[model samples]
Target: MTTSKTEGKQCNLVNHDEIWKVHINMELESAKSWPQKWGFLTESYNQAMQESSKVTDRILKLELPEHLRTRPPTPPEEYLETTQAFIGWRSAVPGLQLERYGRVQCGKKSFLKELGWALDGCS
Candidate 1:
């Protein structure tokens, strides 16, 4: 009976170890993609900022009638906010060392959720 109990405990321990390994592997894979994801986000925000700038410049240069100018199409507000948020995140993610360790100042899941929100706004 003692031998059976020891075997059962060992079996449970092995399963627990396997679960931890899988979790670590998943985190490592995510870390590997962090740079690529960051690059894509940077490119997206840059494009949005450039487009917003062009629209602002065009509006500034235009000499339309005073009455009609009131209804001019403004640049996308969502993109502007997104660009700003991206700027903050760009500095913050590294400062927090989110990808460097399993845990950091900001929870990884929370950071990913915020990232997803930004991405959804872009689309």
Candidate 2:
């Protein structure tokens, strides 16, 4: 459980910590298959963004260096334009595509790693 902060007052989840640690999972929804929505996750992510001004501000246009990008760009391939081609896809990549561009991610980094550097003061 989690609580929203309003008017600088500390709030608590009915029986749980205000700050939570949980896994929000997504499947590998390929282009060929139908899609599904994770509404609870969407709401949770939105709430997280709303709670942190710093996250909301930079979340839209995160410009991580190549090494920091969750997935490196697909490698160039030589194709005869005959068969379907996908190169450099290493593993399952889960994220939400934004309206115009960019993404909001559920990542592979450990919680402690994220706690130390994912949000503020990344180095």
Return the TM-score for each candidate structure.
0.25, 0.16
Off by over 4 Å in 1: 1-11, 46-123
Question: What digit string (tens of lDDT, one per residue) describes model 2 on residues 26-100?
Answer: 223332233244446777787787789776677878787653365334444933332223222322223321233
User: Ten-residue segment with the worst summed lDDT in candidate 2?
Assistant: 18-27
lDDT of 1 by residue, 57-119 (tens): 999997985433333334787344466664565546454443665544754465547566764
Clashes of each: 0, 0
Cα lDDT over the full model 2: 0.48
Q: Which TM-score value belongs to model 1?
A: 0.25
lDDT of each: 0.67, 0.48
As a whole number from 0 to 100, the lDDT of residue 67 in candidate 1 is 30
Residue-level error in angstroms, candidate 1, position 12: 1.1
- Pairs in clash, predicted candidate 1: none
User: Which ten contiguous residues of candidate 1 have the minimum total lDDT?
Assistant: 65-74
Query: Which predicted model would earn the best lDDT?
Result: 1
